[model samples]
Target: MPGIDECLLEVMRLPGARGAAVVDWTSGLALGTIGESPNGDHEATAAETAEVARMAAEQPVFAGDAAVAGPGTRTPGAVPPHPPGLPGLAVEDVIITTAPGYHILRFVETSFDSSVFLHLWLDRAEGNLALARMRLGDIAERLVLA
Candidate 1:
């Protein structure tokens, strides 16, 4: 599995990648970063993006039927069935499209609290959204945070 730096390097290899970061949404901290930030400040960008991720992960409005199951199927605060080491959060990824670029937040489901995600900034003209998304998913799965 790749570490934060390795994974981020992989992210930057994508066609339109301008910047990338592994952030902890719960704490609004950037665990690791590479390339240029959208705001010229990776830390601020991470914090801002964390707010967006935190909302999507915690809001019941984004929760699907799995989060609202009847009586004994699940415990309070517990997510639904997920991949082997990932959290089964209601939202997987959040993509925000802007006039010049695309911001993609791919949630990383860790074995711990699952508060981290991979943020990618891609040029709108050069990026292939579908390919970036798919590759991000793969990278997130293989990321190893120590």
Candidate 2:
């Protein structure tokens, strides 16, 4: 698996990639960052993105039937709650499209708390939304935090 720096380098290789960061959603901290931030401050960007991630992960709507039925309740055909150590929901990524750019928040599943996610900023004109999403998923899986 690649470490934080190497993984970020790989992410920046994507076309139209303006900035990238590995963030800890629980604390709104950037573990690593590269390229240029949307707001000219990577830390602030990380904190803002983390808020989005945290909200999405914690919402019961994203948790499916399991969340509505209560933690341990199960219906005959309902999807199960997320596995322990995973997010409360099974959200893989969140995408935000603007007039000029795209923001992608790809959640990272770790052996521990699973609170980290990879954030990518891509120029809408030059970025391939489909390709970036797929590549980000691969990068998130191989990212290793120290």
Candidate 3:
């Protein structure tokens, strides 16, 4: 597995990648950051993005509504689709596209409370949404939270 810094570097190598960070959605903190931030401030961007991640992860309605995990889609929160017994939440990732860029938030599943996610900012014209999402998923898997 790669460390947080290395993982973020790999993310920046992606097409259209403008900035990347390992953000703790629970506390709205950026554990690591690289490249240019959306607002010229990595910390603020991390906090702002964490709001979206927290909202998506903590809400059960999004999970239940996730018929398909397409762009701008939010995964289910800490519950099983069936049996519905576990208090744990779930998420693959979340993508928010804009006129200027695309935001990809890939959730990192930890052995404990999985509150961290990888945030990637990419240029709208140069970025490939599908590719970025898939690559982020790969990075998320290799990311070690400890």
In terms of lDDT, model 1 sits at 0.89
User: Measured by C-alpha RMSD in angstroms, how accurate is candidate 2?
Assistant: 4.2
Tens-place lDDT per residue, model 2, 48-103, is: 99999999887756765555457667765555567554544478889999999999
Error of 2 at 19 (Å): 0.4
In order of lDDT, best first, we have 1, 2, 3
User: Top lDDT: which candidate number?
Assistant: 1
* Candidate numbers sorted by TM-score from highest down: 1, 2, 3
lDDT of 2 at 123: 99
On residues 1-146, what C-alpha lDDT tens digit does candidate 1 reach at each position? 99999999999999999999999998999999999999899999999999999998888556654545644666676645543434467678999999999999999877776789999999999999999999999999999988
Give each model's whole-structure lDDT.
0.89, 0.88, 0.84
Tens-place lDDT per residue, model 3, 23-84, is 99989999999999989999999999999999988776565335444444544343335213
- Model 1 / residue 9 / CA error / Å: 0.3
TM-score of each predicted structure versus truth:
0.86, 0.86, 0.84
Query: How many Å off is the CA of 19 in candidate 3?
Result: 0.1
